[model samples]
Target: MKKFYIKTFGCQMNVNDSEKMAGILRSLGYEKTDLPEEADLIIVNTCSVRAKPDNKAYSFIGNLKKIKKEKPETIIAVGGCVPQKEKESILRFKHVDLVFGTFNFMKIGELIKRAKKERVVEILNSKIPEEDKVPLIDSYLENPYVAYVTVQRGCNRFCSYCIVPFTRGRERSVKPELVLKEVKRLAERGVKEVHLLGQNVDFYNYEGIDLADLLYMVSEVEGIERIRFTTSHPCGFNRKIVEAMKNIEKVCPYVHLPPQSGSTKILERMNRGYTREEYTEKVMMLKEEIPKVALSGDFIVGFPGETTKDFEETLSLVETCVFDQGFVFEYSPRPFTKASNFKDDVPKEEKNRRLQELQNLLRVQAEEKNKKRLGCIEEVLVEGKSPKGKELSGRTKDNKLVVFDGSEELVGKFVEIEITETSPFFLKGKLLQKVKV
Candidate 1:
């Protein structure tokens, strides 16, 4: 049996992709290994969402040359966005035995078989293969309470700042029946939570079944205490989905809908397809439908032609929306993206200043939001003991982290915690009695 090791970086979708790859390799009699140095085959599942991740992938690939010197037979393969984007450059490295793209996962077994004979193989195909053979590997979830259930593969939105459209290819949804089957299997395996993964998750509409129906269907599955999905496009977030979040018992009230920018001008430039007013309306609708819902969002500061006023509009939206938590990032130009053709005009100092301001503003709001939970008893799925065993760390239904003193036996179970203390980042809780749902 060939021993292989795989390392994945970036979004949950990429993590699921890595799982599928591992499953494929396992079906081919390849056993997974933790140490890359000891493995006969090593795969680096790359991500290009941010410059830091791409830089890390490059650095890791460069370091592999040293490993190759010691173990010449070790097949070093690169896959995902980095391989899909930097096709020929990855081949420049002598140690890289294989380069495969995201869509070419079905061909992994064949690629490895060929690499043993040819020493070098690149399979970055333009079209996604028809086969939807999911991997059958033992899942390596960081927490047993939550498991990512991937319902779709890829994106259709060509947002100027995004590389997802290129790397993930066009939107191709999984069969709804198949998704239900996977969820059922996961339930049987003792998984309690299912977070549906996708780039534009709400856009999942196939064979008369929309994401709403899927949500309702998944909620019916036993053992799943909570269900959540992420990276929802504003254009795709409709009234039906908002209503589903409220009606579906297992569907958590937290939504990760990326508005990208608050300025309509910047949104238009980014090809985000929705205006600030439209995005705001979506938020309003969700709030009206699910009043208790805690909102989370993403923001990119300093796009190609972003101005101070444009940035202030963002701050204003954040103020108006009062998002529970937002992941703010300074715009980093990605190669081959539409925005890359525009002037990288946003000064680094200005970008940093805007990012800091956004962070500071959000910090204040987050602190206030957390304070609301001070006396409330929140349902938290105990993940595990924190780095400081002084408290256990778990996420509330709204996805807020609550650290409390709890028995290790309660790790995978859901327990109600009374929020006693709060911070902008986390809440200190007292494990109130565990209640049966």
Candidate 2:
């Protein structure tokens, strides 16, 4: 079998794209290979979200240049947000055989065929792919219990500081029936958890049906014991979704709401639509509805117009909300984004200070949150062995990572674990009992 190696970067959305590409390659008799040197085809599924990841992609491609020189027959391809954004510049490296955009992954065979004759760069302008056009990958990294299904493609809200609107195009959703069919098929294959992915998942609407409706349908599928979606905007996170989390037993009580900044002025500068007060109100409402729900959020420090007071507001929000998980990032202006042209006035030193300060506060809050679960029991879906050690890793219903001793047979099963120890990132657990398979 012809072996293919792929390195994926960025979020779950990128992972889904890489899997889809793998499915297409598998159709052409290419088996997945861990080693890039042993592969006939090499692909880098990239992300252009921040400066660091963008630089990482560039550095990786630079290293791959040597690999191509030694093995001239190995075809190299780069696809996803980075290629979609960089376009012609990505082909500047002579080693890059083919480049495709986020929406054109299914055409891998044709792109490779064209690349053999000359450099081929195909970037689609549209957002969504035709239904059934993108192949479904049933397997991932030997984890058979969890899956990521793209309910929608692209974003409608073009936050001034973001490049997703340009690279991913507009919001286009998959049909609810199609999504349900995939979940059912996954259920039959023993999948227990399915996370519906999107640029802004709360915006998923096919006709009148929305994400809440989709979640209800997916939870009804035979083998799906846990349900989830991610990266929500406060605009569409209404009472329906809150109700879904409350009413549906299978739906996970975890939400990722990215309140970029807590200052209305900075939020306005970012063009994030909802006000700070509005976002806070929404969070409060959700908490009132689902008392035990755990929140994970995103924060950006040192926006173009952020003042000391604005930074304080962000810190205050973090303190007030006490997110179980906080993803903090220093703002890096991306190309073609409005903030890039708006003069990045936040000093490098100041930005670094703000990031560290925010992280320090969040760390204490996260530790406090984890410590609360010390004697409590939580149901966890056993994922697999941790890369760091021989301990088996699993996640709670609210998305808390727990490590404990277990066999490979427990990888895909749901287990109830008592929190024996707690840390900021994960918990040390003791084996309690196995739940439903």
Candidate 3:
């Protein structure tokens, strides 16, 4: 069988894209290979979200140059954001055989066929594929408990500091019935949890149904113990979603609603389409609905034109919201984004200082929040052995990672553990005397 390797970077959307690619390749009689060196094809599903991951992608591609030398017949393909963003430049690299974009993902095999004959093939601007057009893959690395179900593709929100709208294109959602069918199929295959993925998750609307209705439907499936969605935009989170989360027993008590900046002026410049007051109201209402819900957020520290006052407003929101976790980054210009057109005058040193300060304070808040979990019993979906194999790692309903010792047979089962210690990143636990169904 032909062997292939796919290395994915970026958000859950990219993960879902890679899975679709794997499925497509498998349908072509290809087998997934762990070692890139042993593969007939290598695919780097890239991300261009921030500067670091973009740099990482380039470095990875540079290394693959050697692999191409060792295996002259092996084809190297680049897909996703970086390829979509730098289509022509990517082809300049002698090692890159094909370049495809987010919309052109389904055309990978076609592009490879062309590359074999033409020596270079790039399909970065093909029309976006319909949701049902992509093949469903029997997973190469199947997890018993968790699956990422993508109900939608792309984004329309042109956040000034974001490149998603340009690279991922307009929002197009899959029908709710299709999503439920996929969830049911996953359940039949032993998946106990499904994390719905989208760039703007709450914006999912197919025909008349929205994300709230979708969550409610997925909750009804047998064998699905939990449901979660991520990368929610504050503007799209309506009361319906909040109420649905409260009423649905299977929806996890965890939300990652990103309030990029708390300052009204910065929000305006970012085209986030929501005010600080509006964001606060949504968070307050959700907390009222799901009292035990743990909140996480995304923050950008040094957006162009941000002042000290703007930075203070962000810090103030962090204090008021008390986020359990956050992904904080310094603003970096991306091609084709509105913000990239503005002067990037924020000093590098200042940006670094602001990001570090915000990170330090959040670490303190996270540690304090986690401390409260100590001595409490929480149910965990045992993932697998920790890196050392002496400990086991799993996640709680609040989406916190917990590690403890247990029998290897318990790896895929849900077990209750008594928390014994806490760290900013994870909770340490011991096997509880009782197990629940």
Candidate 4:
């Protein structure tokens, strides 16, 4: 009858980790609660990928101090990237009873019990142990029809501006059999969509099976209607993967490749192995191989030594790629990143200006591309009701959001929709027919 509450920060990986922790708690007879104040145990899953998220995590934990004070017996735990990197530093918040690392969530049940008697701080070393490689089959799914399966962990490519390699450690892929087993189980449980996740997903290679082979294997799952992977490094992404996407019927035609910067000079400084030209080649390859591919990318507006010319090349790349979606961020130095040592010469004002300009360009491109989809029939996987509640919302195979009027029965089914209206962000559609999966 004990209740637990979790506040998750950062990307899909963090969300999946939180779900795994929740599953472990459930197995221990703990029910999840929405409000932290009402829970007997409170967990703050943190992220330190960027300064904004890092600061937000600390701020959230600070707020939880009051609940800990009001309920003296309440246990407060902090885990994820922040704890992985900061280690005991996170325990500076006296209210925090436990501090665990990125790979330590699998042991949450024991950690929670230990924290009850005394403060516990366990940060696993960089290398992921063999036992930790096993996929969490009991992970609680937020959406019954969709789930995130992490096939790989950590990053080997230590980009100058990135802190993932330090926080997540070296790249370690889950056994292909384990991944397939998890996917099959999820499919059996009514999951129609599985997003294969990793810090560098395209780098996934277990034994002899690569991401391409895994995609073909996942497609064989009877009830899995869609397979998508994310956060691919351009250097690791190859034609074989593109071919798998093209040949596999179940694989969605959406790839989130972060090209960091478009200028060769800035790219070199960032330690991103691929050049602007090489990055463009890969983008072109994806478009040529799969004409319907919807490309989303990440861009850092200003780095330590970025010049005006460097920023222009990035703008040029955005124009050339015409990304379906773009996540543009103003660069902030993070601890332990190589770029943090370099002089952050780009003024904050300049970083802001460049970010806005790049974002505007991406927005314009997205609007133009979305407008082209008007009147076209798209296959959409009905997720749930839209924010307005009157219409149902879902996503097309290419990952474009589509909203239309539909019954609740259509929540987990695939439907054909005729795009009636479009915007830079989403598409309004008319339900044409239910897809017989």
- Which candidate would rank higher by TM-score, 3 or 4? 4
Model 2 regions more than 4 Å off: 126-142
Candidate 1 similarity to native, TM-score: 0.93
Clashes (backbone N, CA, C under 3 Å), per candidate, total 0, 0, 0, 0
lDDT of 4: 0.91
Model 3 Cα lDDT, one tens digit per residue, 1-437: 99999999999888877887887888889998889999999999999999888889888888999999989899999888987877765777788888888877777777878877666555546566777765555544445568899888788888888888778888989888788888998898788889998899999998889999999899999989989998788989889998888899899989999999989999999999999889998999988888889999999988999999999999999888888999899999988788888988889999999999999888999999999998999999888887667898989988999999888788777898999999998999999843543
Poorest 10 consecutive residues by lDDT, candidate 4: 126-135
Q: Model 4 clash pairs?
A: none
Clashing pairs in 3: none
Candidate 1 Cα RMSD (Å): 2.2
Assess candidate 3 and give its lDDT: 0.86
lDDT digits (tens) for residues 296-402 of candidate 1: 88999989999999999999998888888889888898988999899988899999999999999989999998998889998888888876877788898888998
Q: Report the error of model 1 at residue 232, Å.
A: 0.5
Q: In model 1, which regions exceed 4 Å deviation?
A: 1-3, 25-34, 131-140, 387-391
TM-score of 4: 0.97
- lDDT per residue, candidate 4, 265-372, as tens digits? 999999999899999999999999998899999999889889999999999998898799999999999889999899989999999999999999999999999999
Which one wins by lDDT: 1 or 4? 4
TM-score of 2: 0.97
Better model by lDDT: candidate 1 vs candidate 2:
2
Model 3, position 290: C-alpha lDDT score? 84
